[model samples]
Target: KRYSSEKSHIQGTSKLALGIFDGMKKIHGMGARERLLLQIAVLLHDCGKYISMEKVAECSYNIIMSTEIIGLSNWEREVIADVVLYNTRDFDTFEIMKQRDGMDKRTYLLVAKLVAILRLANAMDRSHYQKIQGLRVVLRDTELQVILDSARDLTLEMGLLRRQSEFFKEIYGIYPVLKRKRNA
Candidate 1:
């Protein structure tokens, strides 16, 4: 609340991310704890925009890492920070490996997964108009489909999602395809 003024976008992104997270839970071995972390990350991912639009990702990462959220350890905070930092920025494998000092391979993978989900959610709300009325996740053997129900045009969202989908595929080994349908 203190850092974010646009509540709807944050809330909508969180909802979309949770929906995606739940849908991918079984496939990725993420459980309740990861869900909580993802929710926290999504909720605060855009807070950096409060300080600087040009450096939202970095500002957001610093804010998240500096603040103390009870029940979340330092490592967990780092996970959330990384999720926020890379939510919009281009990802670098070597840079991430060097920055994460004590993060094990499994935890690093978890961060990547969460970042992938958050990136998709952010792109869905890129315009801050919340055009997505409903989100449905369907997993196939080779592709993960995100069916969006909305009456509004989504050309911008679809284009951003196409750009973000590559990271999702890199992390999950399954391509994410966005499908839009008219609302009933």
Candidate 2:
């Protein structure tokens, strides 16, 4: 609330992301620590938009690194910051990330996974309208089908989801498909 002008978007996106993380926890091999980082990253992801919309990712990274969030070690903060940093930017491959400073292989992969989830959640609320009333995420074979329950038109959200799905597929080996439930 202090940094984000679009509180609904932040809240909605956080809800969606946490839900996704929870649903995929077993398959994704992410536990409580990753979930905590994901939550914090989603919360502060757009805080940089408070400074510059065009450079939100960079600005958010700077802001998060500068702030001393309690209970988080410097490394944990870096994980969250990088997650926010890559929210809009295309993530580097694992080898490219290995050459970067600060994060180890485990942490780097964690950041990438969180970034993937955050990007998809952010896309679901791109209009900041919270059009999706409910959703059920299911991993079926090679697809992560997000069955949405909403009466509103979702062309924008669906299109953005399609665009974001590639990264998700690259990270998880499962394509994300958004399907509107017929009766809902």
Candidate 3:
């Protein structure tokens, strides 16, 4: 189930997004449609890699921005593209904000929240091994805890999540704690 090689990445990513989105909604002031867009962005996050690994992030952004999604408006597509642009690396969030064309605080937060969740969700399946079987997310006052159910060691996934968690923390104002457990 390598993300770079197959369709399973979409399913895995959607699963990761659902858990993260569920936790995020309780902590952020976002609408249901914005949350659903986050889920769609997760599934479409890496479509660029399938086209060319050389510049996957850039390609994915372009593909998403250009594609006419069945249920999404142009603005919705832009939001998804913006979220995908930062999926693989760190970017200046300020620059991202300026591109929103005078979005209100809540809409800005919605976009940021989508990007943050997408980052963590993608990292949850890092190494492209798809070892994670389930995820439980708990948002506390000071930190966000993600409990992962897996059959094997999750060292890679944890490390990636930690790296990506910085953005999550920046957006949501909570440190991220990722752990693996054998039993539910």
Best by lDDT: 2
Clashing pairs in 2: none
Steric clash pairs (candidate 3): none
Q: How do the residues 1-184 of candidate 1 rate in per-residue lDDT, one tens digit apiece? A: 8986589998889889999998887688888999999999988988898899999999999999899999999989998998888888887675566575555777778888899999999999899898988888999998999989888888999999999988999889999998886443
In model 3, which runs have C-alpha deviations exceeding 4 angstroms? 1-5, 95-107, 182-184
lDDT of 2 by residue, 87-125 (tens): 899887767776776457888778878988999999999
- Number of clashing residue pairs in every model? 0, 0, 0
Ranked by TM-score, the better of candidates 1 and 3 is 1
- Model 2 TM-score (2 dp): 0.95
Q: Kindly list the per-residue Cα lDDT of model 3 for residues 1-184, writing each as its tens digit.
A: 2236357777887898888778767777776887788887787778788778888888888888777889898888888887787777565555456675554565566677788888888888777777888888887789888888888877888888878877888888998898777464
What candidate 1 gets wrong by more than 4 Å, as runs, is 94-96, 182-184
The top-ranked prediction according to TM-score is 2
After superposing all C-alphas onto the true structure, candidate 3 shows an RMSD in angstroms of: 3.0
In TM-score terms, candidate 1 sits at: 0.93
Span of ten consecutive residues with least summed lDDT in model 2: 94-103
